[model samples]
Target chain A: MTKVALTPLAQSLPASVPFVGPEAQERAQGFPFKARLGANESTFGPSPKAIAAMQKAASEVWMYGDPESHDLRQALAAHHQIAPENIMIGEGIDTLLGVLVRLYVTAGDAVVTSAGAYPTFNYHVAGFGGTLHTVPYKNDHEDPDALIAKAREVGAKLIYIANPDNPMGTWHNAARMQQMIDAVPAGCLLVLDEAYIELAPEGTAPAINTSADNVIRMRTFSKAHGMAGARVGYAIGAPDIIQGFNKVRNHFGMSRISQAGALAALRDDGWLGHIREEVSKSRERIIQIAAENGLQTLPSATNFVAIDCGRNGDFASRVLANLITAGVFVRMPFVAPQNRCIRISCGTAAQMDIFAAALPGALQAAHDNLG
Target chain B: MTKVALTPLAQSLPASVPFVGPEAQERAQGFPFKARLGANESTFGPSPKAIAAMQKAASEVWMYGDPESHDLRQALAAHHQIAPENIMIGEGIDTLLGVLVRLYVTAGDAVVTSAGAYPTFNYHVAGFGGTLHTVPYKNDHEDPDALIAKAREVGAKLIYIANPDNPMGTWHNAARMQQMIDAVPAGCLLVLDEAYIELAPEGTAPAINTSADNVIRMRTFSKAHGMAGARVGYAIGAPDIIQGFNKVRNHFGMSRISQAGALAALRDDGWLGHIREEVSKSRERIIQIAAENGLQTLPSATNFVAIDCGRNGDFASRVLANLITAGVFVRMPFVAPQNRCIRISCGTAAQMDIFAAALPGALQAAHDNLG
Candidate 1:
């Protein structure tokens, strides 16, 4: 049997998933995770109104989703005070990132991001055969100055920064973010990922400037909106950049039920406010729990907290492994120095109770194993 | 005022949607279509079981879908009597098509398809800058032999053919398909799109041979299963070819609710059987309606029927325009000769009654406008 030919780029790429999902780990361990917090998904769940909307739309799945996502985009435009042309809805922020990378990065073009930013973004760059340049995090935060300088030096086509960072949960205030946006070089696009913005404090995000030529901000329903499995996200950008996505995206990719759900979720500010308050409470609980356990918790503006293990990466990994074995699913940063901490997503009071009960025994197990 | 840099390929492409969805047309017309029979979606909708599953899953949408699509793939593998490795699920057949083209066809590479088969597939090819070669349909059917010959002649890396072809619902028997599969060039891959196969008769589909390196078969929940808005589709091929999708696909792209809906739909073969029977009845009714109106209907194994307008492309266009004005949404073929026909999807009896009532006026309007 002769083999079919693959493109040189495809042949050169490794077949891999950026992150192994918690479900896969559960399947391997032959048990379900008691608390599903490893992936930074909200345990608070989607708004009750969104759930009702999806349930109502479930019987109408015969019709294809509106390829333009017209209703959803119109509502989003109104929400952000921008023209509908400035928004593009897709399967998720991950899908949007993939399309954005394909639009801007050709083979051998330089792309810049923090050393340990979102892995899915890095995966897309590599898939498109773009050369990636990385700058290290400064004080556990994405260093915008270093990133901007690297992009200019390398003539990078795109630079990525998560406003309220993932894995580390650190954030930059609006003023600092506005300066970063201003510093973007003429030819470089800045991908401002604000997936966690809804959970952050007030003024965490810079004001929306839909006409800004070099900056595209991404937000999602997967965070405080509590619909990660709904797979709905949108990018806010200049009309030209937003329209560019149409040239390559799967036009009918959104689920009709997801559209209805997200619209409802967006409209119910009361539900969103409740979720924010709950998440904030959970965050404080996580911080207090860490302190009680003799660990240092990083200052966080996002839904999750990163607690310093006060040792090296290995110790953090050991602690995480022990936690998982003890029926608590948690994750950690991968890069050195930063990897001295393990990340834990905020969950319900009961889930936090479980985590609080498990951490001391897991730490003891790690210490005993090391000895 | 400086612009962000776009890749040369991006700069060269037009920012356009492949298909203007029926909903957009409705929005433009300032009213909903009285009958949405265009787009070939199942007006019958998904199974009740599937709807229930999706509604149930909606409350649990805070978690990301299993990136591996483990449970659904296992169910699909069991249903098809194949290994899980032979299957790769995606957002839809459209997304799978895009990924397949990216895997096999690079910029400037040759890809083959019927001239007016599936425009979305062609759109993806163009999006990736692949040089497309087209063969005319033989007697309104996708000619497999012609497609094979063109692939060999062009040294094409990929060839696409839809069985029980769209636009003109004509199909070839399994033996003919097997012969065509055998003719695939050694280095070329045959992307056999079997999206409509479930609506076709027995012996219409070529037997699955997952070990066959040159052919990959795609199936979807969008058509006969009536889950188009759910955006679930899968491809069955050699394990190696299936695995290659992981190198470039959006791994976490599938909506958790959609996965649940599709799984439930797949398990309810009884509902599928019921749909097939209903569609068969709808097809007969469509044929009778065409016969009463002095039109000839083509033989169709799929859910939709193509009725000959007994005139040229212009007359057919006028007929379709009148139908839309009469609030009956029907579509037609795009290429010459075949453009002499108008396509109508299988609808419920009430919708069929509306279409039957509207056809005579539409025909008269076309004739009166001609003078």
Candidate 2:
């Protein structure tokens, strides 16, 4: 066999994906999961107006999407009350995060994040050859103070925090978040991943600071807007920081149908309000079921709940396995303590009922096998 | 303004986009272009089945796309008579090219291409800190012998050639392509961009050699399938080369709707046949219109034609500017000789009529302004 030369940095990396998508799991198991509650997706779906817009634009796929994503960016700027120069649109938060790392991270540079906050972010840092310095979660939430201190100590170029975070579904209020933003060191860039911010309570998302050169807040249509598959996300930052993305981003990456769909979705404030109400109700139901089953539930500002398995990581893994076997898809954190809980996304009542039915048997199966 | 720290390479790079999209032009002009023929897009549109599939998936955009793009890859694998492991799908050929460059080109690595080839590819190489070595085109076509010679001379890690080349729209037969592939330096990778392969003649595509580790072939649904906005593209290469993409690619970058739509488009051979016929007809019409205006066209294997305006680079640029002013969108090459020709994409008869009506005026305007 012939050997093609690869970059030394690329060769040193492992061929691993950040997360095994639920679809891959289904293919391996030879059947699909009955209730898709693991990925923190909005089962309520995108607004009908967005769907209509995308379907209408389907026939016009012959043309390339505007590389600038002009109209969509303009609309986003108006909605946020900022100049379009302060926003940069991309395929998704994941894609934007990858671009962000490329702009700031060089080999051997340091980056700080919660130990298990978002594996995808860490994956990007590692992919760019950045050395990761992790701070453990404090009270099941990302420790902003620790992350800031560690970044300063290591002379890290980047720090990542997900407001209304994933896995544990815990969040800090706006004032606390503002403090963290202010405490970000001089040379380090704070990446505020607010993918779930739309679902968080009032006073959760800090005021948009377009002039803040040290912070870039990323928001997406995937969570509360219910268009994860559409792959639309934007970053709000200082003009210079936003313009830097132009040097590295795939300019024509946006899907034309997605641009149309996201624009329509963003304009429909009523649809967003409705999704919030539906997600709130679903969260309450999740709390009720976990309480009824003698499990403790974490408070959530996002569209998912983490149910305490009341045991070690091993017990939780066994329970998750049984749940998968029972056709319910739920995920857990990768670290200790947090791994003792299973995270479930808010779904329709029917889907939740399926999870509700499967959990008891799954728990029993876990106990019977382990004990 | 506070200076956020960027990597040294990034700091040294200018904030620039490879191409300014047509929408930006429209925004500046304060009106839409009457004839959209600049980007070489398939004005014939996507398969009806593809449009339908995307329409159906519009409602399902709440869920994230299968990060693996599993079903589409499986379908592509079957179509090409190759294992799924030999294929890697991405947002578009542009994204795949970016990843390929990241894998092969580290800082200061030598990469070779024709002087006026795809600018987007060059943009990616520069973005990754690759030192590009250019060889000028021979007789308005990509010179395989010259490219191979330059690669050897520079100890190039990667060589790029677009078969049925863009900007010029000329191609080489499969046997010549095979010679080029066989001549690639031992450690260097040959990147064959066949984004227009479906529209090329039957003998144009070289036989697939998945075991050949030195070459990676890229294709897109953008042209003949008419789904440029959907951003679906794939690369066929050796398993190890394909696997290397996993180390750095955004695994979940694909839009779920695009995956579904592309799979449907690939399965509908009759639709592809129809598109090819339409594109062929449109190409003939474009040739006729150029001839009526007393211009000479280069032999074109792709959907677009390059018309030599019987003048130098300055005159061709003036003609293009006049065309834009007359509500027609067209493009021209960037180098000296190639810049004497203007590139125009095929469009429907009504759009062609508009272009036809405007071409005489544009030419007169160019002559009047220059004389």
Best by DockQ: 1
lDDT of 2 by residue, B255-304 (tens): 99999999999999999999888888888998899999999999888989
| CA lDDT of each prediction against the hidden true structure | 0.93, 0.92
Show model 2 residue runs off by greater than 4 Å: none
lDDT digits (tens) for residues A1-371 of candidate 1: 46778889999999998878898999999998888779999999999999999999999999998889999999999998999999999988999999999999989999999998899999999999999999999999999999999999999989999989998999999999999999999888999999999888899999999789989999999999999999999999999999999889998769999999999999999999998899889999999999999999998988899999999999999999999998899999999899999999999999999999999998898899898
**Fnat of the models, one by one?**
0.88, 0.85
Q: What are the TM-scores, per candidate, against the unseen true structure? A: 0.99, 0.99
* Residue pairs of candidate 1 with colliding backbone atoms: none
